[model samples]
Target: MIVSGVILLALVAVGGYGLLSGTDSEMAPVHRDPAPSSTASPRPETPSRPQVPRILPTSNPETFARRVAAALFTWDTGAGLMPLDYTSAILDVGDPSGTEQAGLAADIATYLPSREAWVQLRQYATTQYLTIDNIAVPDAWSEAVAQAQPGQLPPGAIAYTIDGVRHRDGIWNDVPQVLTAPVAFTVFLACPPDGDPCYLLRLSQLGSPLR
Candidate 1:
């Protein structure tokens, strides 16, 4: 009987050991979620600004005029003072703000930093060195008569604005007007064979009239 009891106790101890081992094995395993990885791509940043059209603004008239004058000087005078597609004429009366096409620079309220006439000589043989192509010597300019008839505006007639015009000599001719400052006008090729749009530019100096 003692031997049988000892054998039963040994069997019970073996069973308890088995149970503890199973429990330890289950608890030993570590649990964790997979490491996170970024899936989104980096986005580029843009400037936050109020976009406006970059153009010749009418709000600032002075700035606009100055810009135009500078451009004309470079276009016309920069070509070695060569007689270009247009001719330079005198208006006689000094008017800086005048929009007349044919005019004098001195008579105008302002002149460029320096304007000097350069006489060029052309030679084909031993003698005739001067030619009209080299430099233009003025002969005479005929007075341009008005093609349009002169008349006052009818009663209640709508009128178009003449920005710098002091007086209308006639329907087609304008009289000389004085400007408070100096300005510039550019002569352009009026019409072309290719049928491109053409226009003349008028530029007003920033400051003039010594005031």
Candidate 2:
């Protein structure tokens, strides 16, 4: 599941992704400042909370991609689950070769709030979910594939740009509150043509997906 330099360049041309560092990849995750935290009692895990999948099982690339998108954006801060717990779920369905794990972790970090932010959100019982508007193969991807060197891309590698709305809910000062915003991004995946399950590769920068 190694991406060649040529394909990396093509992806850059199509999607405005930042240079990936730390693991010798081609895209980097956005960094955010850490928020200060206050000492507080630990929250209790709800007994009725539904179990989240670690490894999502699906051979269909589109289905896998949609699921991955949802998993990345959905979470409940008051469920006694930390950001890493949600991150683990997405990583479980990531590149099995572990080549892109570090990069993916960095990508996930940008989407999720920091530990201090999470704690503060918990006080308000903040929860978030994505309402997907559409998912399609970006036309620019065809150009990237056409220019890629032989065997440069992984088996069944594909890119899908997702358009969606993010909805955040919380109880603020004893009042229920909701916020919504539009979000878009591209998801790179490999679903071997032999019918093997799909695996997430890399993600484009948030809101800068290929057309």
Candidate 3:
């Protein structure tokens, strides 16, 4: 009886092995990434903004004062002096057309104050006081000249805030003869940072009247 029991158990074990072997064979496969990643920190991208004009520096303070005096050809700060034609109805208030290439032009000489104590140009930021023609700035540039404190005013100073289009070739000159393109504008000027009281003059409004 014992021998018969042992034979039966061995037969059952053999049958179980045959059943699993008959089943479909299978194996788990591993996959690797095509490229490896670095553990180093990542870099950031820069922001894009509008461009501005590049005006040269006055070198020193005295050089600036001399240039403005020479350009207008007058030592008298009391008079209405500006750049442009000495004659012609178009230039009576001074030549706004004298400035050129809003993108590559400058009047560093006109803007910087020589006598910081007398002119008190320090009232405004150094960057503000030294910019000649901020033409590259398509948008309107603010004038803190109007908001200056007393004792800062000189005898005759004027602030021209220009806001207009840069025609195909009109960045520098406002006249059509120099430039064929018609860049329309409505720029205006206000009184000085130092001397005069609040006086306003539109570029178009002043010259035609004086003429």
Best by lDDT: 2
Query: Which residue ranges in model 2 land beyond 4 Å of their true spot?
Result: 1-51
What TM-score does candidate 3 reach? 0.18
Please name the candidate that would achieve the greatest TM-score relative to the true structure. Answer: 2
lDDT of each: 0.21, 0.75, 0.23
**In candidate 3, how many Å is residue 7 off?**
99
Residue range 1-211, candidate 3, lDDT tens digits: 1112211121111100000001111122344444434864544434332222211224232232223222222111112212122112112222233321121112212221233221221221111111222222122222323444452322232333222222111111222221121122212222344533322122222111111
Question: Compared with the true structure, what per-residue lDDT tens digits does model 1 show for residues 1-211?
Answer: 1112211121111100000000000112334444455665544444333222122323232333332233322212222233221123222111223443332332222322212121110010000000111111112101111121232111111111112211101111122222122221221111222433222222122121111
lDDT for predicted candidate 1 compared with the true structure:
0.21
lDDT of 2 by residue, 80-131 (tens): 5787989888999888889888878877777787776776677777778899
Name the runs in model 1 displaced over 4 angstroms.
Answer: 1-59, 75-99, 103-208
* Model 2 whole-model lDDT (C-alpha atoms): 0.75
- Residue 68 of candidate 1: its Cα lDDT? 29
